[model samples]
Target chain A: MPTYLTQHQNRFLEELLDWLRIPSVSADPKFHGDVLRAADFIKDRLLEAGATLVELCPTAGNPIVYGEYMAGPDRPTVLVYGHYDVQPADPYELWTSPPFEPVIKNEKIYARGACDDKGQVYMHVKALEMMLRDGGLGAPCNIKFMFEGEEEIGSDNLGIFVKANKEKLQADVILISDTGILANDVPSIEVGLRGLSYHEVEVTGPNRDLHSGLYGGAVMNPINALCDMISSLHDENRHITIPGFYDNVADLGPAERAELAQAPFSAEAFTQSIGLPAAVGEAGYTTPERTSIRPTLDVNGIWGGYTGEGAKTVIASKAYAKISMR
Target chain B: MPTYLTQHQNRFLEELLDWLRIPSVSADPKFHGDVLRAADFIKDRLLEAGATLVELCPTAGNPIVYGEYMAGPDRPTVLVYGHYDVQPADPYELWTSPPFEPVIKNEKIYARGACDDKGQVYMHVKALEMMLRDGGLGAPCNIKFMFEGEEEIGSDNLGIFVKANKEKLQADVILISDTGILANDVPSIEVGLRGLSYHEVEVTGPNRDLHSGLYGGAVMNPINALCDMISSLHDENRHITIPGFYDNVADLGPAERAELAQAPFSAEAFTQSIGLPAAVGEAGYTTPERTSIRPTLDVNGIWGGYTGEGAKTVIASKAYAKISMR
Candidate 1:
């Protein structure tokens, strides 16, 4: 029979709810205190979960929560990675409920970090607790927990930490619970990872926003100039226009591509799932190929001049955009 | 003598305030009624400005307000382009006053349409009124007013209207006052217009948001993958890495480049103006060069799974971004 929910499980979930209530957003410096509090909270939980030598490791930015559960020197070691920090909840009104207030709705917990690293990180802690109760030992592998508070911001210090403490963090393979499954009911394993590139561009025409009436014919509108530049990045086929962008791209073999395609995917189902007219991707590739193997460029955000209240007839002094590539 | 700013000027501003109060945001369909009201208000204003033939040209989308003030056949025809619609006043709370309230603080009117086409459009109407009252019946230019209600939403119909009514809209030059000046005091002129390209990219990995714990090692995190891809687009010097991005770029000559560089711009002043640590851009170019002649990329907006309230340890099934270029 499956183990039923116990009083301990209820208590564990309550603690998680408490942790979710703190807005430990590391991306915005305004949440600096909250991040520290969250770090302390995690450290306390680590101690409660029977982890020895729990410490809040400081970094140039946010701190890292480090802990260990040693069975014996003879056991193999396993390092677990996770982030406790989160992105800022802006355009905040879109949320059905407050971001920091943990709310369980329709069997799914609806909060900023519910399905993100926080909830996943908690699962590992709970699993560890279950193991401790069953037998005062973790898995056959000795476990080390490294939870950084700046993963959402970018694990800036993690590289240094990993390099400096290679011996301390050594393990056979790293176990991280920071990704997700294909669906709510279906389980999946990710076999490959894609790389990323990000950039911000600013376009300026006049030294400042100009009067369109007096200068419309003579002065360049940065926003219009920016739009033209962005539009040219992709051809009608949606391939990135960067000359040598695809030079380093590795093509998937037919067999490997077929294997990936074998994964259950329906164009109709995918469209319905996302509420889109149809699946859109590189002109010649299947949905899976477009997503998993193909490179893509996207504009993450853009603004210039006055994107404000009513119309401002002023040609904006500058236009700005953030781009991402994968 | 310049016929400007009589006691009637204050009253005309007051009337414009009344018209500006309507929140005619075209991007959101929910503001359909508001948009209609704004159109009617513009029609009324045109009629008041002695336009003989005023019509609201309906299209598949928003209606266009068309008016004619033909002084005589001998006079040069001037087509005035303006928009009655406004952008969505989101992040709405950021406003010091209500977007549509038309609050006059200092000498500037504070409202969504204050400096935008509305205020500028009003200037033309008032100018016409001054001309008419002063018995300048046969004005220097025959005016045709084309006030669109969808310029904020890309002027989807204006392009069609311009194409369809090429003969009717023909003019010596299009006069638009929908832009602003370099500063509050400095007079400036715009000499060029940039083109635009806008696109959205959806990067998919697994079929659904996954539990990072179980799938972190094997499955790819679209967010991580996205970041990596974005990071790869630019080299250390901030040059775009897309292979042939600069193939079609028209390089400015040294004299022209030097002239642009000599334009009154200070790195420190620019940095302080935008509140940044320092300016960063493409190396070996002046700030003006980077913003003007050079092509650039930016992520206009980005979102993936769990950009919500709290931390969600979700390896998002997909990540999305909106990009624009110039």
Candidate 2:
């Protein structure tokens, strides 16, 4: 007694559940077979959905899923990009249900790649099937699918494949549905992403852990040395201390900043959410501006030796920091 | 036919090994039984060594093992101090064998209390046995043995026990086997030890870990904040910046300092030993002077958030430092 649209929606959900079951984790070689299975499954589905020239394009790394549907001369061509791989399901004991075993609980499909591309990509495949089956939908654009298996592992092979066959892969524009949305209802469309500049710094003092009591004053502890270096990264006004770091940094005009400030945000709510007495940043800017518009130097992580038990009088040999500049 | 010492040495080692088998770890409550057993074991051994009035002097915490031996008039009274307890062998995984399971590997009696008083203290008990057994050995001093079960823990009850029994505990001077000896053949007696003052400092900025990309430039990270504050503890010239920190510090005369510097030392070997390019300290002082004579500030341990894996873009809520001034 269900309508055709309702049945199609049910079919889409069922198919996605099948795709999510494969633990196609490209980061780990243990999931190599699963990753291959996931890629083949996508290739078969695209062919069944009326895509011609469907093929699993092999590379040195994981294979790429390629398929295209040609329309009449005047239709604009659109290339759709997605990935069939997922991040590693690590600290595996933390998961309530197994990462490979897909289950719908609280109306949310709990799986490794449930939302990250596998779920999002499946929607496009089913939408194309719906239009093909209904026969009432006019062709708005020519479609090309280029799903890779290595996006979760930095997409090493895809760039090589693209550069080698640029003409074959050419399209009007590429559309991607991968960026995270805020929530089901209160979501904002992401136009672009912030580029990240990552650096790892290691400071060495003594070659090995030394007794702090025996060599406390004479030795320079790497933790303390590292802290000193990190402290100097930001000056008195919290300005970055790196030489010429802001040379290429984009600065917005006052009018633009004022317009951006009009966006809804509450500093009080922000403080309460993260549990702070108040917010602090670059002297002249608001919290939002400092985050989005301004460049930042952050210590993503820091570590040394002997961070355990009652006390160990150790001056660590080395200290490491992972800093991100955005 | 071996000497009496050879026979006694074998017996002393067997007895000490039996004592070391008990896990007298005072830091944790689970080892309460072992701690008590250790105290009783010490009392029994002291009595067997011919000490009179051996008693397990109870306190709020673990008991104090007390014993005495007397001689006729004009013998100088001597109080011998030691502890039967050992530090918690945590990071127990780092040990080659179970902490309580004593083993002699590579000519070393490798165990939790091997070098600490269990080994050192056993030497005194056997010497007492040897003197008492010899019968020909003259008594130059009247001895009182005070071995406690709470040295690994801060000797909290021993103070109360000592204060309450001041008259009974009285002696000319205390003979302690606690301090370190330099080497096997080149031994020098340690006359005194450095006084330590430790403090824990906590720096809080935000209430929780925030996404570094969203709140980085605007939010003050506690790790960075802590670093800034710690860096200010010493000026550019390496002089401590704490007001009146060096006010009551004793200054050695030029002649005394020159005499102290005359001790045999190799600057190159010292640097190579600790794997430092060069030693560092206050403006004008040798490494030995900086370590022993002058007071020092050191970060024994420091920690915050996201110290694991490749990268975690988190602005941690709190940063902590365990600082020591000696």
Candidate 3:
């Protein structure tokens, strides 16, 4: 809606395409140099946007890019949080074009990190530049930018950096554009975020894989044992059976529940989108509440024994599963 | 031991070793030539042992080596059943020596089919030779030999061959050395054998893998669904829960059960041999009875989702399991 944004849109798009081509995937160590180069890109862009203090703060993992535009000592401050790195573009064959080679069709850029955080973070830098250079209007408030390079990898180092520099990061409010709104025209915001814990479990039975026909009746198969253990984690009512699992989970009052239910959702559309016959979840809660307000235990992966093209009558020695709780 | 057997024992072992080198693995199609060569070896050995009639009977799969030595019509007939094919030697690294290259180690021959029907079938050919050529001890009964080359692959073609040539295979008694003895000095015989049925199951949830953090509590994970299904196949007491599964199963009487219990058995040794904490089976049956008489259901294999290194928070679109019943 601003004249500055419309006039310099082509240049802004060019800058984003250049950054997207760096392949700054922090999860893989082979991309370490590219990750650092991506940080430098951010540092240069921040400096060009008239930020006074812009530096790359080192950590045990990838470094954090920090920049600041101080209006004055008396003005309220806003801390903007974002990341420069992206999740690995694996199963690359699924993409229509190469991942790092950004392509724009129908006015939408196609790339790994184009949408995630790079696009959003770029908007902040350009907005700051527009206010400082486009018009005579200067900064109305103090703004601190923290663009992390390890956000895609659970942000392992961001916590340490935040703790060590708490005074430097002080602000009246924090703004994060990591999550998406309902629509571009009808804006929406999430009030809360879920915490996650992941774990891997292994069940061992016999010492070696045994012939199913020779020992099936007498020995307990590790796969079957693992299945039995996993099945018991949830009760008949779809509630987690782990002791004290729900003891600390906070319960929202009826008013809050009503407010959450007001979010636009269609059970038919949700089921059809996922190609499920119907939606299923906790017996008492609706689908929206189940995804947002409730904790969940899901087996992300399970494997054991022969899984080839044909049948192999073998009782595997061990079975494993990866579980995640949200 | 007879003088003839003792005198030519070296030659007999040499002939058996040569046959074992053919690599007649019926399970793999890559060894099709080796399988046919194995059948030819059996046919030549039977003829060398003074058999009047020997032929390779053609079938849908591998051929069956049929030979006969008629000891006059007045004597009772004996049908000797065996196989020249061996099970595939896989995970080949586990073998001390090459599977197809026979080796003598510590007075025992090492090969895939050494103790199976190949060795046992060789003994029958050598015995017929010894009786006809040594000390003029001519055959005492009409002996018929039927060595199939598809026993390792469920004997698929053998059943069809038997049904088609029932009259040609007729005999007063059938002798099969396919099973093992209790010891070299102690002989043992099995009165019956167990029947087997195998199956593969698939559980499908969503059309595509979903992010656990976004849809975990709402969507049903296929791995968890498959585990739940597998766990319900047996009851708390380990008895199969399928209806009509045991309708045709026969129960052994108290007298037979007592006789079976009298056989030499050590629960401690059985448990220790397999490196299990303890032997577990159906609630009311002993380990021996469970393996031999009682029916069983086991999940031989289970697989789904990410089974690679580290963790992947994904709810898989599909999960699979292989089950076998005995």
Each model's backbone clash number: 105, 1, 0
For model 3 chain A, the run of ten residues with the poorest summed lDDT: A179-188
CA displacement after TM-score superposition, residue A119 of candidate 1 (Å): 0.7
Q: Residue B32 of model 3: what lDDT?
A: 88
Q: Kindly list the per-residue Cα lDDT of model 1 for residues A13-104, writing each as its tens digit.
A: 88989988888888677788998998898889888777877888888778889988887899888888888887676546656789889888
| lDDT winner between candidates 1 and 3 | 3
State the TM-score of the second chain for every model: 0.88, 0.83, 0.88
What lDDT does each candidate get? 0.69, 0.78, 0.85
| Candidate 2 off by > 4 Å | A1-74, A80-139, A144-162, A177-187, A253-259, B10-44, B57-64, B72-74, B84-113, B134-139, B147-158, B181-186, B197-208, B240-259, B317-321
TM-score of each: 0.57, 0.80, 0.83
Query: Which candidate order results from sorting by TM-score in descending order?
Result: 3, 2, 1
For model 2, the local distance difference test gives 0.78
lDDT of 1 by residue, B1-326 (tens): 34444646767877899878988888677888999998898888888777878899898888888888888888888888888887666545557898988788778888877766688887877776666665444457788888888876556677898798888788877888875455656565556654444456667777655434333323344544554565566665667788887788888898988877666656676556544445566778766566667776554444555433223334466765544444
Q: What is the TM-score of model 1 when looking only at chain B?
A: 0.88
- The DockQ of predicted model 2 stands at 0.43
In model 3, residue pairs whose N, Cα or C atoms come closer than 3 Å (at least 3 residues apart or on different chains), thus clashing, are: none
Please, what are the lDDT tens digits per residue for candidate 3 over residues A1-326?
A: 67877888898889989999988887677788999999999899999888999999999988899999999999999999999987666546657889899999998999988987888999899888888875638899999999999876577789999999999999998988877554456477777877777788999888877776667788888898899999999988789999999998999999999988887777887788789998777789988888888999999889888665445567878889988888
Model 1 chain A weakest 10-residue run by lDDT = A211-220
Q: Which candidate number would show the highest lDDT if scored against the true structure?
A: 3
User: How are the candidates ranked when ordered by DockQ, highest leading?
Assistant: 3, 2, 1
